[model samples]
Target: MITLHHCPQTRSMRTLWLLNELGVPFQLRTYPFDRTLRSPAFLNLSPAGRVPALEIDGARMFETGAITEYLCERFSPDGLGTRPGSPNRMQWLVWVHFSETLSQHTAALTQQHVALREDHMRSPIVMKLEAARLGKCYAALEARLATPDENREYLLSSGFSAADISVGQAVYMSRHFATLDDFPATADWYARITARDSFAASLPNDDGIYDRDFYAPWPLE
Candidate 1:
């Protein structure tokens, strides 16, 4: 059986949503977004003390992108993944991995706005810079989705794949730090992909982090 060590609203949720879409039976072990990740037992599962540790086929795995590629190749290669030599393979790989580029900025913003609980502990410059970076990522998505030839409803011309799940989940985290207002196409694409039942099922039951819907960059004081 597959076991997913997940922390809601984190990169792990990308794995969770993909698993749901795969329709494979798996056990989920939820963890708090705290120092519990650094505990000895948990560290054994994921040496880096980060979430999305997985147990499958008697082996352990971490890293959301690697896990996504592995699971899709093993379980849904023709559907959620584009196999090598396939027409959309290169683009698939690009967008799937690009999600991390977006998430890193969101992670930084989260650190500034949410993790650093006190105003004095946060840096307005970092918050603004990270949030601006997220906007740039949004622009990239907007351009991709607005491809002139195809009415690209998804990230790839082929159709929806793990790339959508990967980036969509990242955008979910990013929404707290940056609004989608400026990128109309990206906003529409985000709405379309997230309307999937699998995406809906992956939402956190209780707050995992960021108590507010939005975290504006801390204004200089």
Candidate 2:
């Protein structure tokens, strides 16, 4: 059986959401977003000591993007994934991986707002800049969704796929740092995709990495 090592609100949720959408029976090992991930046993699962370490077919896998590609290709190639030569393959690959772009900035903002225990340890400038970067990411999604002549209910023209889950999970983390109010198309798309039962299933049952729904930028601009 496939086993997924996950943290509630981190990138691991991307894999979890995909797993839910794939409809495959698998074991989920949930961990707190803390030092337990650095334990020797966990490190053996993921050399880098990160969430989303996967054990499948007796092999261990690290890296969210790699895991995502492997799972989609293995379990849902034509559904949650696009196989080679498929019409939406290129777009599928583009949007699927683009989630990392947004996630990177979210990581920075998270470090500034959540990871740092003392106020003096955080950088307001970094918070503002990273949050702004998330806005740019949101704008990119807005433009893609509002592409001329085509009405996109999801990222790919084909329909909902893992790409939505990938990016949507990133957006889920990002929303705490940045709001989607300005990007109407992206906002609408986020709302539509997040309404899915799969997305709902992937949510944290209790507290997650963040203690609150939103964290305002430092200095309160």
Candidate 3:
């Protein structure tokens, strides 16, 4: 049986969403987003002590992107995955990995807003810059979704795939820090993809890193 070591609202949710979409049976081991991840047992599962450590086929795997590719190729090559030689394969890989680009900024903002305990510990400059960076990421998605030649309801012209699940979850985490109102196309696409039952299933039940739905930029401008 496949086992996913996850923390709610982290990159692990990406895998969880994918698994739900795949409709495959698996075990979920959840941990709080804290020092427990640094324990010796957890470190052995993920050397970096990250939330997305996956155990499959009697071996452990870390890194969200690697786990995504492996799971798609193993179980859903023609469905959630675009196999080699398929026309959409390149686009598939690009968008699938592009989630990390968006996620990196969210990670920074999460550190600034949620990780830092005291107000003085958070830097306004960092908060402003990271929020701006998320806007840039949203702009890129807006451009892609609103291409002149085609109207893409999802990231890929082919249809919904793991790419949407990956980026959509990133957007899920990002929305807490940045609103999608400015980029209409991206917002619509986000709404379309997030409406999926799979995405719904992956949502945080009770515990999460953020205490509130939205965390405004520091200093209130």
Candidate 4:
């Protein structure tokens, strides 16, 4: 059986969402978003001590994108993945991995807003800059979803796939730092995809890294 080591409201949630959509029976091992990841036992699962360490077929895997590709290819290639030689293959790969681009900025903002305990420990500039960068990522999604000739409800032309799950979850994290107000298409797409039962199943039942729904940028002096 597959096992996923996860933390709520982190990149690992992306993997959880994918697993839910795949409908595979798997065990979930959740941990707090803290130094527990540094424990030797956890480190053995993920050398870098990340939340999304996967145990499958007696092998270990890290990196959200790699795990997404492997799982989809192995279990639901046609449903959640666009295999090689398929028409949407290139676009599929692009959007599936592009989630990291958005997530990197969210990780930065998370560190600034959630990870730092004291106000003095946080950098206002970093908060503002990372939040702005998340807006830029939102803008990119807005453009993609607003394609003139297409009614693009999902990321791919073919239909919903892991690419949506990947990027949608990134947007979920990004929303705390940046609002989707200006990006109408992105907001709509986000709402549409997140409405899925699979997305709902992936959500945390308890408190997560962020205490609030939104984390506004620190005000300048």
Measured by lDDT, the strongest candidate is 3
lDDT of 3 by residue, 1-221 (tens): 89999999999999999999999999999999889999999999999989799999899999999999999999999999999999999999999999999999999999988888888898999999999999999998999999989988999889999999999999999999899999999999998988889989999888988888888886742
Tens digits of per-residue lDDT for model 4 on 58-92?
A: 99999999999999999999989988999999999
Reference-based lDDT, each prediction: 0.92, 0.92, 0.93, 0.92
TM-score to true structure, per model:
0.98, 0.97, 0.98, 0.97
Per-residue CA lDDT of candidate 1, range 24-94, in tens?
Answer: 99999999999999999999999999989999989999999999999999998889999999999999999
Show where candidate 4 strays beyond 4 Å: none
> How many residue pairs clash per model?
0, 0, 0, 0
Cand. 2 TM to true fold: 0.97
What candidate 3 gets wrong by more than 4 Å, as runs, is none
Candidate 4 local lDDT, residue 67: 99
Residue 201 displacement (Å), model 2: 0.8
Clashes of 4: 0
Better lDDT candidate (1, 3): 3
